[model samples]
Target: MAPACQGVAVAEALSIGVNYGQIANNLPSPARVSWLLRSMRISKVKLYDADPNVLRAFLGTGVEFVVGIGNEAVPSMTSPAAAQAWLQQHVVPHLLSGARISCVTVGNEVFKGNDTALQAAVLPAMVSVHRALSALGLQGRVNVTTAHSLDIMGPSFPPSSGAFHPAALGHLRPFLAFLSATRSPFLINCYPYFAYKEDPARVPLEYVLFQPNAGVADPRTGLRYDNMLYAQVDAVYAAIQALGYTDVEVKVSETGWPSRGDPDEPGATPEYAGTYIRNLLQRIEMKQGTPLRPATPVDVYVFALFNENLKPGPASERNYGLFYPDGTPVYNVGLHGYLPPMLVSNAARQ
Candidate 1:
């Protein structure tokens, strides 16, 4: 019933990472959150940025982190000096301080939209960051990569025949080459809830929720897929392989369900959200892999650690957390842990 998305006693070391997003004001301090995660046995966390406070709080906790460079910072990262300086200012000190930072994402979902300039800068920025890492003698030790949105794919159905959008190909081709040469993972944010909300009538709720159904098969590979999450992963693998790079590993940088939403957002209730997460947690516990690659279990980071009240999107966007800002769970999904209240300093305690 434990569901912190972290692995334990598995030979493959297969673990699930949780996105420790901090876009809310009422959440507990990073120190207390660290206690909560370790209590639940989660050792991997992904952050939207390299916040020094969070990094410092988790010092010596042994939780591996995958930090990021926001879209606004991508163009600047294209410069080698800027990349190195940024890393030194944000990442290096933490590493020296015993923070286990395992990866640096240059930019996030650059190809998901039509920002020509930002899209143009992503690969160069990645290259520059990677070069800076190598210069610092930490190339393979800390990978350089980016998280992508599933919208980058042109046709993700059927798994085996997936391909990147033609326009995206111009950028992805070289990006894949960089990832291959540098040995970094291709990260993607896959959300099955969007698919169900878009067409709940046709997209059976059980399938998206990971319940037992007839499941579909890829016409080419004839692989049966009972859930949309695995199919989305294999489709990404197909896309990467189509680009002629079979060696690059694809990781789900973000995936989760919203426990609450606006009236129009169908199937966004707490019950469905709990089901989606619970089922996914079960699969991670079993070390389940996609039908296409049984040997390589799908690496995932559940969308968030807590619901961010200030997130600027649909209600669903702000409500994707497994827990709320007050450190209380929004919905029960088999996993349970305690989030201690804020610690009092000597002056405050007195």
Candidate 2:
């Protein structure tokens, strides 16, 4: 068993999910992170890979997980034997230990890139993984899905008139069918921060930050959207509905603002990041839903748990984390964690 860490008490019951990316060389050990998350009352975590160390760390913690298979592994999942072997090795052992893994995302943003082969293999890979789960009698308990980039949408402004890009239509049609048949959700990485950064002049900071503003009205639906995140989500719902898929639920797989960025990157500061996350937490605590799906509460996983130093991209890309590697808050959004000193050495070895 992993050594126990000190747990800091948090007041609010964490209603939001957070992405636990491990792209950094300087991250705390999974055991330590588990304690931190538990301390903060964050019950749900999304991992980009089925890292055994992480799955093992959370055993019996009752913290639910959404583990993933990376893009490079997508092609291999097309083979039934390969999929079964992968799952049995990486996932089953943890499940047997009482790990609460609710979903398996086959690939992350496979459609966003220009890789046509990866796009073609996505659905087949998902089907194979789902079949493997069924063979093991874990189908319904563990849903199989993949995350998509917002680039898949053609026109997303008027939420009611949202539609998928024509280039993506061919792949999405069958993908939606698979989701509907399996009763799984459509995971989307919606980044309002990207929109604001792209056109800060035109995009109101208040709108994206969930601050008070006049808000925008969808000309067709007549629904008022006070926040761009909700508008983006509703637009996705509209796009999904347009493709004759009303059954598949929409979930935000990733969303967050960066605490720091290059000079060119607008609205990227500690203040803006804290405001965005704090306000988002408030809305989530109230169980607020998108205008389109008012009854079905919006499911969102914040972009990252720790600022990754190794990620290759714009400065903002590596600055989305809410905490530093030492478990210190990058900017206080009312969340706190306790990283045991004993685990600090363990984390360094990793």
Candidate 3:
């Protein structure tokens, strides 16, 4: 049977979803923010956490949500009781109130670092959460999974020859089996911009930016790809297939280009960011699947909603937002949202 999540064909032109990260101090409240997303007709969202205020605001709005369980909470989630309590506190109330939640990511990129404990707890947390959802009669309705960084892929070149790092395979094998058994998607954070930035000389600027360019060929699959994003996605599919789990689905949890960067950061500009998103939106709207999975449309949640001023690291780390805190478009790709004008406008005015 086809995955239930893939059965619904989101109206491509108007169905673009954005990741709503709240790491910054200046983001608009969830209530006003609801108006902004509704105005753009965005019916899907992915949150880094199950924020109560955000959940309450989007209640009855018909926007489907993909909430998260932070890495710090992974250890707690390993226990079925703690997982149940967390659901009761963070998820159950919202679902009862008519929030359309579809997936719950257990942790974000737990395998990318040296946190052995977080990595070990990842799958168990997912299992406990899945069991809790089942006990509550919500398993079929909500998926349990985790997102991983592209760094987990050992070699992502040639699209079809993708393979997971040998080190990650030890942990990933059991994780994939869990997803296969439960029918949840395997989320990966794939960013082609990193390749271009790391090796600008070899990586074509036009290709990474989604500009017109002669594409590369995957010798094994004999498929030609015009864009790096598709190639990266296909590579992931290849990697997954190599693991003997062809039925498992792969989804992109984060992918975007920065609009600004430090002096040394090349290809980080408003023009490239706009171009990349516009082209990406166009492709996703076409319901275009990767070369490897031609029958399945790519599932994605764009990197971020707003520039996170408090985010550490390089300048580019904070500029991935499509909008500013004041509900202004950072660089237009014809999609913008406004936080609610008043905190209780929806509850009070409506």
Candidate 4:
């Protein structure tokens, strides 16, 4: 077993989850990361893929996981044999060892891409995965769903006027039906940072960063929204309600501010990033919910645990991490983690 970070213990527990993305080569081993997460008192984690090393590392740690089946693998999940095989290999082993696997996301942001074939396969894949889970008697225990990009929504302003893009409606109708029938949550990646970056001249940084501002009032419902995150979430709720489904829940699958960016990427500073996370954490700690669903607390997973050096795209893409690879925090958001020393091969043998 890998050693735990020395002198590290649980601090103030936050109900928020963090995304454990591993699109980098320099990241600490999963065993070491397990200790880091525990030290920070983060009980929930979201992975873009069902990585066995991570699952095995967190076994018996009492951390709940939301694992994903990648986009390329979605089509194959339509086959019962394929889906069952996947669960047996990647998920079942860890579950038997006491790892809490609460949800399985069949695909990530399928509609955002231009691939029509992938868009059509997403729902079928989810159905097959859900069926396989039922066959294995793990249906109610593990909810099957998919995460969507905010681009799936048509007009997200006014909150009450929110609707899914007509191009995506055909796929989303059945998608919402599946979520409603199975009592699963609709997961969306909400990035208020993007809005500010896209239109810094017009968009108010205070609104997006959860800072104190006059706030915007939705003209239709007259609901006051102080933060863009809540507005985005409420818009999603409205979109789902428009589809004639109110039984489904909506959760933020990924949301974070980049601490750095290119020349063109605005509002990607450490200060803004820290403020966004800190303020969001404060609200989440208060058990706050969106304007549309006042009774339901907003469920969110901050996007990325560590800076990924190998990630492709803009500079900001690689800078969303809350921590550096060595476990040092990128900014002080009241979160501290310790990456245990790497285990040598000889140590493993011992």
Candidate 5:
């Protein structure tokens, strides 16, 4: 067991959210995480699941949450009874405990592949959940939505012309209507690092890193974008607008740079990660929205508070954490936090 988090404070409330991923053999208790989050004044958090212990730990803490239902459960969620049962079991208990459940994500990145059944079930599951929320009088208070990987877009370059792949539109059109009608936000996980890494020759390092660079112009909109993040966001806006739904909102549910990566993974250093987060935090603090929607402030959630060793993929997949499991900073973001001292095991006494 790790000691309860203590001795961390910042100047203002953190509108920024930090992901709480626990795919590791070792992790601090939810009680300790509560202290850590409160110490930093983080008012929002996104979880891959609705862990009862975690929900219990954050009771009455005023920390809004966006919880998810795994991909395997998407098909089951299409059944209204299953959806209501899952909500009653996993969600209602939390609400009963006074947990501030802000959003329920039906499935994550389900459109990234050819799983037509799962893909088709995405919107239905979201509908079931939204209807369930409405039945329970939680429609406006607890929004139902899903997150998508940037891969869903056909041509992300020159962002203003962005469009969903033809294959995804069958699912996206109805999905957009559901979101617009329910007044929920569309969540997208945008990673500019993936773009720069795949085409270093064409994608300038400075542009993706949020460093000073001569950015490209959108020939269509003539909107000057100096950073790739904003460009990616605006592209999504354009795609949504093209769908004939101009009233829906888009939010970045996941975005972060890794502090470490394999030799082949270019530009994944602590310095660059620090720069990306610092610059992003500055922009967010300014309440800066996309170039297309300057009046609406961009809502973002930074990925992974602690790196997970068990995450399978490229080295970068496990290295996006802002902090290590032992509660050490991966890189300074002008804020310092403390994790309680780790408890020792008897086996290590040898």
Candidate 6:
């Protein structure tokens, strides 16, 4: 068993979040990870799965978490009994022990492909999960929703005219309604790095990296956007509003740049990745809001915590992490986190 997280000073409060993924085998134990995160003062974390060791490690430290329901598990969750049973086992024990889990994503990027069965099951699974949460008396405590890939948007440029792809509109309309009714934010994974990597000749590195650039104007609202991240966020707001739901708030579920990549993958370097994250963190720290939604600050979760060596894809896919597996920063962004020596952590557990 892993040791209880100890010997770390309490973290100072910071609103920035990071995605904690564990697709690799060499990552440190969750107890040690909890220490690393607290030292950096990152107060929110989103995980691709509800790893009990992780939730258990953070108990009572006051870090907020957004847990996931993997794609394969979504279909089974359509059964109210199954959803209830899953939650009873995975969530209840942790919350009872004071883990601050705030959201449950039923599936990820569900409409990104043409799998009719998966598409059909996503919403029902979410519905069943919501019902189960209410049955467990946790509906008001935790939000229920899913993350979406930005491909669901059509012509995702020029924020004002943004609309959903005809193929995704049918699914998105009802999905947006559920969010509106439940008072949950619409989560979209926005990656400007993707744009620049695909066409570095056309996509300006300055604009995509949140560096100084000639801002673009949305003709309809006359809103000016200096950075691609804000533009992509407003584009999602436009898409949601077009469906006749203005109350649903839009939040970025994932966004990051890679520190390394294959030869063909352009703009994937530590310099670009560090600059992007540092700038974004600065904006988030200042509570900066998008031009369209000037009053409400954009809520974002940076893509990942550590670069998982085993992640399958281009090298960039495995490189979207702020830190390496040893809990060292991939590139320094002034966040001085600490990881105990392996022997120290193991001895503490023993």
Q: Write the per-residue lDDT of candidate 3 for residues 94-178, one digit (tens) a residue.
A: 9999998999999999888999999989989999999999999997999999999987899888978899999899998999899
lDDT, residue 25, candidate 3: 94
For candidate 3, the C-alpha RMSD (Å) to the true structure equals 4.9
Residue-level lDDT tens digits of model 4 in 148-233: 99999999998889999999999999999999999999999999999999999999999999999999999989999999999999
Listed per candidate, the RMSD to the true structure in angstroms reads 3.4, 2.9, 4.9, 2.4, 3.9, 2.5
lDDT of 4: 0.90
Residue by residue across 172-237, what tens digits does model 6's lDDT show? 888888998888889999999999989999998889888998888888888888999999999888
Better of 1 and 2 by lDDT: 2
Worst lDDT 10-window in candidate 1: 1-10
- For residues 68-144, could you state the per-residue lDDT of candidate 1 as single tens digits? 99999999998999999999999899999999999999888888788999999999998999899899988789999
User: Model 4, stretches more than 4 Å misplaced?
Assistant: 1-12, 343-350
lDDT of 1 at 222: 88
lDDT at residue 240 of model 5 (Cα atoms): 92
* Error of model 5, residue 209, in angstroms: 1.7
What lDDT, from 0 to 1, does candidate 3 have? Answer: 0.86
lDDT by residue (1-350, candidate 5, tens digit) is 22322222333577798889889877777766776677667778999988888888777677888899999999999889998999999998888878889899998999888898899888888888888888887778899999999988987768889999888888889999989998999999999888877887888878887788877899988888889998998889889999999999999999999888998898889998898998988888899987789898999999978889999988898999888877788899875665544343222111
TM-score per prediction, in order, is 0.94, 0.95, 0.94, 0.95, 0.93, 0.96
Stretches off by above 4 angstroms in model 3 are 1-13, 336-340, 343-350
TM-score of 2: 0.95
> How accurate locally is residue 64 in candidate 1, as Cα lDDT from 0 to 100?
91
lDDT of each: 0.87, 0.90, 0.86, 0.90, 0.84, 0.89
Q: Give the C-alpha miss distance for residue 21 in model 1, angstroms.
A: 1.0
Considering lDDT, which of the candidate structures 3 and 5 is the better prediction for this target? 3
